[model samples]
Target: MRSPNPRILYTALCLTGLSLATSVIAQDSNEEVSRIEQVIVSASREPETGLNLTLPWSRIDDDALKLTGAVHINQVMQRAPGAWISRGNGQESLVALRSPVLTGSGGCGAFYTAWDGISLRAPGFCNVNQLFDVNSEQAGAIEVIRGPGTAVYGANAVHGVINTLTADPRQGPEHGYAVEAGPNDYYRVRGEFRAEHGAHAVGVHFNGVSDGGYKDNAGFDQQKLTLRHDFSGEQWQVTNALEATNLNQETSGFIRGFEAYKDPNLKKVNPNPEAYRDSFALRAYSRWSRETGAGQLSITPYFRRTSMEFLQHFLPWQATEKNGQESLGLRLALSDSIESFSWSTGVDIDATRGWLREVQDDDFSPNQPAGVHYDYEVDALSAALYGQANWQLTSRLGLAAGLRLEQNSYDYDNQTDDGSACAPEASACRFFRPADREDDFSNGSINLGVTYALSDDHRIYLRGAQGFRPPQAAELYRLQSGQEVADLDSETITSVDLGLRGAMGGFSYDASVYSMQKSDVIFQDADRQNVSGAKTRHVGIEFSVYWTGESGWYAGIDGNIARHRYDSDANLLGSRLDIEGNDIDTAPRHFGSARLGRDTALKSGRSLTTELGWVHMGSYYLEPDNQHEYEGHELLNLRLALALGKGFSTTVRVSNLLDEDYAERADFGFGAYRYFVGQPRGVFLEFAYSPE
Candidate 1:
């Protein structure tokens, strides 16, 4: 119903033209310009360079991450285009990568999150609060693939993928330690060590944090450890990575009522004092590679174990739930070049066993007898076969295609009685257990693309892809009180993308436009029953630009204008609701960020950098009825960094520089509106030291 401001787009285009003109006039006809060096590994299974990957992708290197002194993933992901991360509290978040702030049990499964090369969780079981399991805070680099990923990845890559890469010692070794202090009695200590000897290398990273929360009865302390080892010979190599994390969090619940974020007193109140979350996770993976006659062979095996428990504060009935899983997986691949084509083929297999237990300890109103709500165990097996080929049809044209077939099976055993409601306290049972059953899903995906190089510094491409995801175990097993069983099918989304990206002189830019349609969408009805067979549509334009000046000044912008709406009408819990053409709840139509900064080198062997950033989120509906809307707000941030002699540096970060009072997340459910209060202006100071 609304469109972005035309003046903004005009201004950006004018700026791009001016930058191109400057590049042409500054160089002589005989002068040669070196192309920018770009390296990416997640777009494909192997290392590649430049923008010829035929997809929209981005990377945040270690240097940019260090300047922010960030403590959360949200802080570091700000520069990524067409992406958003909504922080619920200290370390909890909901991710939207070219989609809405997907909520509920199946929300987290939309985005495939991984560390190194393996996913953090199994396919059937994904925790909405899973990002805490990753060490992104200390990662050397973070790679993001927007829209549907390639066929090399399976299952939960419906929306996108985020891979955290471990630091390498061969890139030059340097050890560092840092300490930071901030408002609300926040304190953190971090350490890193790296060394290389001949063909062997090792790296270790550790961080611990303690925070006295701003809200009453809300605080947390957590720690993470990461270790990596790499050994290489003339024709073979072995690499191993290990990560462990422990967390103790006093989670916060939504503060009820409309415009609650504007109330100063309400922002400092914790409605659910009994809410807490505890979790421990361990992950390790190893890879072996060798050069063969046909091509290069690589095999990887990974293992993961995780346990977590938290109070369900969002529901009317207060319950405590615990869940854990252990899994083992293997991936083998081979890649080789023939003539003008490069091909890669791979197979992936994994097995997992997990359980869930929950009980109602308190009832908000009309108390029912305390009883078990859900108790079950699931054993799942998954396997996939995938292949991709890239061909250079001509000097200026390239073609790429990929395909994957996957199978997922679940064996569920109910530990509780199959019933319509919790027995003794039927009044308080918001969940029911189904009879033990076995379910299986077979899914496939195909992608095709073609790219043409317009010049030495410009390229254009078009892509079409189909992505799918099997039903999550929680969606099938965790049912509402009145529902006897959940009959749901796999969800799929088809997307078509067209765009241009390139680098000229000191400027780099990427622009894309795309449309998508999704089928068999699983969602909660008016009565809170989980069901499937709904449809939705997505369409958007994404743009990102950066310019580096010879005078040490830089400017960049990452923004998107998009629309997501219901595509069809369906029967919802005996109610004839016509939701066709309705805007998706919590999906903003206009959002983006801009940063202006400068870097300078001082005479005293020191370097200084300062940045001013702005973030914007447009208004959106809070209910499917479109009766309630949230007027989104904009915020400002500032950061200053100073690099001293002897590998020592200091950073000062100021969040909410304008002190805009807003909600980090908002929703209307069960006849009430809720919000997670946003933070006020706060300042943090960090100091680091490393030996040369």
Candidate 2:
């Protein structure tokens, strides 16, 4: 049952009006209307040999995504199969695709996450779960690229890319907002405006949300502001943006799971396992292009700076945490195909700086020890050069190839001195001399692929590529623990991909199958050694379909299943893994999602749309002993929406429609029992208004 909040109740009432307005204006008389008159998607790379390929790259139009009733950009990305989101009991989240990054730790910080080419990755040890200005509000569309773009995107592009394209400037007045309040006293309100004056345009978005924890120590509150401006003249265009978010949230009490199940109402040491962080970002992009008799040539340059603070244990051992990362990149592309070849080359560079500190507390154990302290700074720099070429072997055959070379270095200095366990105001503390280390590392790889046209409407592609991720910070630090050693070299992979794409009978299908092997697997072995072993291997395949034409019906299916095993002593697992065929912890062997929906005209001038979706996750092992398993689970969700003319719209969303309880991942405490809790069923009504 939803808590009755006046603010949320008012929002529902407003939504009802949008539903009525859309219905009154939803006559087929304007069925010919189109939201976009022109589409330009080549921003990712220069035209490939198969410029005509119709691949099913998953995309969510802002209008449709808003109906999901999700406030986070990462949350909306869940619509894509194979993509995984490991959310914390409260606000933090860890994400990765097929090749999972060891959750938490700065090294596993999502294999990669970026915005307009700027890496959203933070420099904190918790980098793996950065949640700053990367909000989902005011986005025009989100493009989820399924596989690795190493050849094209470089280092951070190890797994996948979720690019959030901001909205374009509107030519007229616009005012739209939606408010939502639900069962947990969770409420959010967002609105924005955009306008264009000749060659100049400006837009802004503001949003805020609050929710009381369903359990002890679990409430959350957040606010965000985003702004953008664009200007163009002749053959050049320029754009700038700033996004900031201030989030203060407490530990929405854990599900109270311990080794020895205790009292139904047990009070933990940290009454509030609370954490709060502020994220700020500034970025700019400028591009210049001109038509050439040979083809089209364009040059783009980008710069960004982000700062974030994570109060490690804001509610308990709380101490201030600070992190900042900056990046600058420039690229030039000349698009032109001779009688048989087309080529493009780009160069990018990024540098990162980080800092960490342990704030001491005396509450629980104020007893004996240094009060608080902070560490020096650690910095890293990475640079890369890449080139891509495509050859038209003939009118029906094409070849594409690319190679990227990269180098990075790391330095840490100025350690904090241990206060003489007895000092006045902790002053006069000795400062450890700075110790710095630098290493030269480089990686080079190539991607070779081809497209064969079977006819005018069908094509087949066979792509095989090799790429790798360098040893991260954690792998190196683990050396001090006297456990697993080190992987002095780059962790690499070589995989084969087969794809088929075509457009026929108002239907389009783009499918692919991939089998990849991680050479010199860089995984923490059973002995906790970060050594090179034949174990870390990833093999998987995926299929996606999208269709929308004269039928007024839209349907999409996306799913993937991956099987992995390390070279171990286990005879039970076919891969000969050490655990005797026992799969890795937390890796779901089977996971998939499907969406079915239709678009139809309603009475009056409004339109009605309904959607059904299902998600399935296979069971996984929870403990190394393999005695217990986190059972598998399935979920069903539904949403219905009405679109009114202008920016007015309404939607009803039901999540966890089946009311099932299952853990997406396990976070066992020091206790013995397996602790887990799944999200309960939730429902919400949404409303919005936007006009051109």
Expressed as tens digits, the lDDT of each residue in 1-692 for candidate 2 is: 32244333323433443343334332332221221111324224532222233222455567556667674444566666567666655556667566542553333532556555456653222266554456566567665555555355655454556666667656334667788766567788988888778888888878888877555556678887777788776765567666666667664333435421123344222344555555555665666666667566666676666666666552234556565666565666666667687666666666666555444455333222235444545566767777777787888998778788878665655355422322444333321122344545587777788888887656788877766666665444323223322436665667677877654444445567777666554554433345554444566776555545344665555566676544354222112234734555566665656566777897767888888876666655554335555555666788888888766788788887977655545644334344334556778777767663
Error of 1 at 112 (Å): 0.8
TM values, all candidates: 0.94, 0.80
Worst 10 residues of 2 by lDDT: 29-38
Going through the candidates in the order shown, the clash numbers are 0, 31
Q: Output the lDDT of residue 343, model 1.
A: 92
Worst 10 residues of 1 by lDDT: 27-36
lDDT of 1: 0.83
